[model samples]
Each structure stands twice: as structure tokens, then as C-alpha cells.
Target: MARGCDGSEAGARLRGIYRTKQSPIFLPDFLRSRIHVSVCALICVVGGWPSGTEERVIQPVSNEEIISLALDEIDGERRAEVAGRIAASPDASRTLAAVTIAVQTMRADDSISPPGEVVQRVLGLMRSGVRVRTSLMDVAGQVAEQVREFLCTLVRDTQSEPALAGFRGTTESRHLSFECEIAEIDVQVSRGEGEARRTIRGQVASLTDDTVGRIAWRSTLTGAAEREIAADESGVFVLECPVGVYELSARVGGSVVRIPPISVA
Candidate 1:
């Protein structure tokens, strides 16, 4: 029916089980008892893991079957690796089974990055041709509850007076209202050559010196060149700016701190 990426070869992308849509057949309990029990046993074996024993390593009978089996591993690290392998296959990616692996792996360890936007991108790519996984629906629902906040913050007016930029404001998250300031800065550029290739680093600090955040470096280089940066945690960032005297600053709490310009050349 379905399969995992490892051991078994990836099969066709499933549109999912179509019962009535394809004119399904109804069978009597007495006639289907043997088949039903076998299916139920398989479900139990795959869905119940770690805590549930009686596990025997064997070929994954179906896509959902092996995915559930891989997810059963007691160790999240192992599960992530196994699940990642399975998700890479079109056969496994088409089912909610894939989302389950990603979410469970992340929930086991928040330090894991696959549970966030990375999952979103994968689901987005899969949904292009397959049925949406039910397991992912709840995550989508909770995120949608506050869609307006992200939309408003992502789109802001920078031309108005400082107060009207829409980037400086307070946002209500959970039960607390937090002060937020957003800005778009030109990327930092670096120069130099060979082992002497110049580099720059930027950091934002709280006035109390409690929290120091690095900036995400990304900019178009004109004279010199800029480095592209990526970080899993973006709340605060340290950016590497190339060589040049430029304006740089970041907002912490309700205030913005501007760093005096520095030159690498």
C-alpha cells in the first residue's frame, strides 16, 4: 500500500485511500475478521513503540507502517534521522505519517529546528501534489489563530515619523504584551584577501547585559562584499558586516541602540 524511503523503494504518491469515491465494497464481519485482525495488529505494532514491546525488525509492510515503526524509537535523535530519511521519499511525504515524525521528533527536543518553518516548507512542497495530512491540520490551526500578528509585523511602513513606522510597538502574545522594534538594514560587506580575508561581526545587547543577540548578516555588496547569514533563532542575531563605515543598530525591549560605525579597511 505505502512504504518508507529506506529498505523499500519509494512508490507512487498516494492520493490516499478512496473508499466511496472509487466505489468501495462492503464486507461482512465474519468474512473479513482474519484480514481485519491482521491490519489491527500491524497498526498496533507500528503506532505503539518504545513503551510497547513485542517489536521485531522486519520489512515495512506499508508506507504508514514503517513510518510508525521508525517513529517508535525511544531516542529522538535516532527517530529524527530515520524520519528524515523516510520524508525524503515522495511515497512517504504524501501522508500525514511524515508530519508526525517531524513534529514528534521536534516535540521531544525543542532544540531541534526541523519542527518549525522547515516543516512548513516540506508540507508546502508535498501538498503541491498530495492530499493534506490530517496530523498537520492542528498545527496549522493553532498557527492561524494569530496570523494577523505576523502579517502586520512582516509588513511595515518605514517612511513615517519614528513613532509611525509601525515597526515600534507592543504585541500581545499569550498573556503578556511585549515591546517590539523591527528594522531593515543594509548588509555588511567584507574585504581583504587570501588568509587575510577581512570579516565583521555585529551583536545586540540588553542594557542590563543579560541577553546578547547576534544579527543575521545579509546584504548586497557594492564596493566590498557581504556575507549571507542564517540562524535558527532570529529573535536576536549577530551579523557579519564587510568593510566600510556604516550605520548599525538593533532594538532591545522598547529601545534602539545605534553602534558607532567601524571600518575594516
Candidate 2:
């Protein structure tokens, strides 16, 4: 058996049903239908309808939301709803256009991957619990620092013989030397017999008795720095490379010293 509704109680129940129907809250179809019946009964008893129809206001979508929608993150029904709003409102369309243009402009800027050695160093630091800045501006700063650290300033360069006079023979070799804070670099460049590429031999030495353990060469033209040659106990190393500009790097003691760029041609 169900309890019957008294006059005041019935009025209060009718008001609640009408409020549920007009509220923004979502309801299932069966519950909505039951509420509709109560609203109609109340309307008949009161002999009038509600003052006015409730209006549904659309909230403005944020820029972040627009970007998410462009990225296809908002899917299915929500995607349709957002797309419809964007298409209907000129302001929303303009906002989406601005965001698209900004993203395209950023991608159009020149970008290059850092060298493999730099990447390894950064990864090692992170593994050792060193904190690295992750902002866009910080990326440029970090890359600049990496490049600066690898590039040693040229203190002096000495050429053995003059090219114009040709004092030696056609197979003459030239010697060039450079001095940095960590080490002094001596390099010899000469053409190989019957070979197309040239031969480069170098030595890295420090005044304070720090032995150079490793020497690596990077070709500016090919952007390759794969092979790392080991130096002798006296810090002497040799390499056969193509005719191009190269950047030589050596690891001495606890510091890495980078010699200035050299050209074989």
C-alpha cells in the first residue's frame, strides 16, 4: 500500500518535480517522464503555466580546450558539440584560427637535434639526479651551452710552410697547432698516396701532466662523430678522414677540450 499525498505535501512535491525539469542537471528518460506528469498535474491545479521557458546558455570554450579539440583529444559526442559551437560562433572560429597559425609558425622555425654526445651527457646528469630546465626558452639556452662547452677558443695557429711558394714537393704536408686552456693540439694534414681522402694525425698534451685518453672527430659536412680513437700514453692519435672541415675533441683527465675547426682542403 502507498501513502496518499496531503494538500501542502502534494504542492511541495509538484514544485520539486518542476525544478528538476527546469534544472541543468541531466536525468534519465523514465525519471523525466514521471516528473513531467507531476508538473502537468500541478499546472492544472494552479490553472497556469510557469512564468517563462528556461534558456540553455552555452559557456565559452577556453584556448586550451580549443587546442585539445584541434589535437583530436575531445572525441565522439563532445567533439561534435564543441565543433558545432566553433562553427556557429565567429569568435570561436577566430580563436581556433589564431591557435592554428601560432602552432604552424612555431613549427616553421628552424630546429636541429643536439649532438649524440650532448644527449648522452644530459641523460647521465638526469640519471644522477641533476635537475634540468624543461621550458622552451631553456631548451635554446641548454643547446647553446652544449655547443659552447664543446667549442674551445683558438689561442694560436701556426702553419709550417707557405702554400703559394710550394717550397717542399707536390706531396708536401702542412702542420697546424692550437692552444686551449686544457691542452695544446698539434695536427698534420697531408694527401695520401693514390688515395682520394687526406690523412690527419694529431696529438693532445697538457702542461700539468694530464694524459689525453680519448680523441673524437666530427665532420661538419656529414655531421658524423661515430668513431672515437684512443690516444697513446704520450697523448698521440691519428685518423684518416675525408677532405672537409672537422671539429676535434679530446678528453683529458676530468675535462673535455675541443680544438677549433680545421679544414683539410
TM-score for each candidate, following the candidate numbering = 0.20, 0.40
Worst 10 residues of 1 by lDDT: 11-20
Identify the candidate with maximal TM-score: 2
Regions of candidate 1 where Cα sits further than 4 Å from its true position: 1-197, 209-241
lDDT of 2 by residue, 190-265 (tens): 8865566888788888755766756666664455433576678887887788776676766666556666556677
lDDT of 1: 0.34
* lDDT, candidate 1, at 8: 26
The whole-model C-alpha lDDT of candidate 2 against the native structure comes to: 0.60
**For candidate 1, lDDT tens digit of each residue in 156-213?**
2222225435645542111101122333232223443434344443233243432323
Q: Looking at model 2, how many pairs of residues clash?
A: 0
What is each predicted model's overall lDDT from 0 to 1?
Answer: 0.34, 0.60
Tell me the number of clashing residue pairs for each predicted model: 13, 0
* Residue 96, candidate 2: alpha-carbon lDDT: 85
